[model samples]
Target: MDVLIVDDEPLARERLTRMVDQLDGYRVVGQAGDTASALGAISAQDPDVVLLDVRMPGEDGLSAAHQIGELDDPPAVIFCTAFDQYALDAFGTDAVGYLLKPVRAEQLLEVLEKARRPNKLQRQAKQTEASQSSHNGRSHISARTPRGVELIPLEEVRYFIADQKYVTVHHLKGEHLLDETLKELEEEFGNRFLRTHRSALVSVQHIQAMERNGDGHYQVRLADTEQRPPVSRRHAGALKDLLQKL
Candidate 1:
């Protein structure tokens, strides 16, 4: 089984790598010092399990785990932290194992075996439970690209336009094609994103103004983007009310 070790400390990562190397079937695929790098590694390497650290700079491991859960086929997470207080929170994320710092080789092997035991049905059940209980939504949206998985921060998103099966994410850097439906995006991010039309969802935080075109159809003008998604008659009233508040 492939394993990725994530920790801010180089020594910690080195320790985990050595332990994983000693295992018969497991090999260290990659190592990361922070959550961002860890996520990028996961996308590129597609490891079977991740030895994640609970606390780190920028986004913590818990938040990272939440985003990982959003992936279609996420690797099993095994949190390795110095503090035991995060045990409950870690388990709440459906983590396969939570190993305390200065992990013993035996404990590591045992948790790795435990991580391999869950079937698809069991994993799905745990994920469903975690989603229902955890009110916090995803901080970033992930899309698979030719290079690998690309993560777009919610703050950078301008709008999402649906065209058939794919939804194009308009963000600050550029656009990315996402394998998701508008309804799913709407349901998950209704508060931050306003449904301008059946085919589009605009970021409320990025709305610059609402205007009518020459044909007298309303459209939303979002900041930092030229694309103006048309406002459907059905959703126009709600958009107007929201614009008033903004």
Candidate 2:
């Protein structure tokens, strides 16, 4: 299996590379010093597994792992860090293993033996399960676009409207169709978004005003767009209460 080692220490990287090279089937494909270089290497090499460090200069490994998970076919991540405190957090991601610094040859081999890339279906299932169980929620939403998988930051999103089986993500750039239900979106992003109607969930941060239209129906106006998603009578009171807090 191809492996990528990410560590700020060159000596540490060399040691891990030597250990991986000693293994019968695994080989070190590349090495990165920081999360930015690591991401670039992953894009260039597409390694089967990544031995990542927890802390670095810029973006930490945990945050990098989240972005890596957004990829359509992400490599298995095996954290190699000195801190044991981040073990629980590491497992929260799609990590296959977690080895401490000064890793033993035996431990590396054992972890590598079990590290295997998950299929697309398995990945999707794991992502769904993780989203359901995670309390902190995600910072970005992923969609499969015609070009490739696009990672849309949640801050850019205006609202999510249910369209039959799919949910349309209306964001600053444009709309992207997602194969998710409004219920799942609500469960994952309830803290950031509010349910304006049965078919729509609007961003609480983007809501500018709530006013009654000519027909005596309530509607919400969001920032950066002219679209006014109707507020259902059942949810209008809750919307008003939330708006008052803002």
Candidate 3:
């Protein structure tokens, strides 16, 4: 299994990497000191599991994991914290495993053996918990890229369309398919995003026009883009009101 070690302390990362290297069927692919770097490493390396630290300078491991949960094929997160109390909350986050620091080799091996990829439901639960406990919603959306994870500010977003099991975020630059659901996003962003379709939520700020197609289907056009997601009957009236207010 590929592993990424995320800790603010160099000593902690070195220790975890050494222990993981000693184990068979596992390799330490990368290491990061902060949440952003850890996220970039996870996106770039596609590690099977991450040994994440709870406390850090910027975003903590738990909060970062919540954002990571939105990415497609997110790695299994195993939080490594000095706080025993935080470790006890692992089950609520749906983490496969966690280790209390200073981690022993045997404990590391045990957790590795038990680690598994989290499903959509598990990721959602983690994000939900993070949102409920936090004062504000997420400022940026994380998207996986070959080089690393790209942070897209919510301001640049045009719309969110739920395609099958995934929701695509249409932003200023481009679009990214995320593991998040439209409902989750709606709850997260609140009044910022208006439901335009059962499978779509559009940014009120990005609303350019509402035009009817040849089939008499009204599509909500966005700013700085040609893409127009169809509006469903249920949400069309509300969308119209939102546009009028905007």
Candidate 4:
């Protein structure tokens, strides 16, 4: 199998490359540090299997797999990560395999032996799901920053407001600009977030009250924060009805 090794760390990539090199049945075709480069490698090398890291600087592995799922001919994926907590989410992407960090050569070799590409029909079905945004929603939001990747639990996020191309993730710790759009966020976090405006998705847990400002516009107040994102007339009625049910 032609294998593509993707990880943010140079050492991790080199180590996996070396392991795959020693294996008789597989060949390392390319290496990548993040999702963008990985996609490019996938296009250029057309590897049969990808060893993807779960967490990275900007786009995490799961999201990358979700994107990869859209391809007409997608490769089998084997996720690599330090945290075992993401195992379930990793599998949800229909990955053929999953490996923990400090991967054992024997384990990797076994996974390779088992990796099978989905048939054309199966690939089409997965692509359809991705187009419809029906894949399993992520449990935690992957936030990218200058320091490193920060995994924010869904519970900590108060709201997500669209700002031009990016969505602002307002959490208990503060706010971070997420690359995801408001629509995608709403689709992934349905039931957990209530749409107050076209640009805002407020967490149900954080919404404390519905208020009317002096200007007569309605607003949704979030817990532990003074900033209230305006409620649009289109969704105001639905928001009010849902809030009253609680």
Q: Which has the higher lDDT value, candidate number 1 or candidate number 4?
A: 1
lDDT score of model 3? 0.78
Q: Over the stretch 1-246, how does candidate 3's per-residue lDDT look in tens digits?
A: 778999999999999999999999889989999999997886556577889899999888888888767765467889999988886666567578888998999999988887833433345446545655763878899887675788999999989887657788989888887867777787787556766665677887788878898989889988888888987543465567666867
lDDT of each model, Cα atoms only?
0.84, 0.83, 0.78, 0.81
* Candidate 1 residue pairs in clash (backbone atoms < 3 Å): none
lDDT of 4 by residue, 42-135 (tens): 7666677899999999999999999888753467889999999999999899798999989999999888877844433244335445645765
Score candidate 3 by TM-score against the native.
Answer: 0.49
Clashes of each: 0, 0, 0, 0
Candidate 3: list runs displaced more than 4 Å: 116-246
lDDT of 2 by residue, 23-78 (tens): 99788889999988998887666677899999888899999899888753467899
Best by lDDT: 1
Q: Can you give the TM-score per candidate against the true fold? A: 0.52, 0.49, 0.49, 0.48
Order of candidates by TM-score, top first?
A: 1, 2, 3, 4
Candidate 4 Cα deviation (angstroms), residue 13:
0.2
lDDT rank, highest first?
1, 2, 4, 3
Error of model 2, residue 67, in angstroms: 0.8
- The TM-score obtained by model 2 is 0.49
Worst 10 residues of 1 by lDDT: 119-128
Pick by lDDT: 2 or 3, better one: 2
> How many steric overlaps does candidate 3 have?
0
Model 1 has an lDDT value of 0.84
Q: Which 10-residue span in candidate 2 carries the lowest summed lDDT?
A: 116-125
TM-score for model 4? 0.48
Deviation in angstroms for 147 in model 4? 57
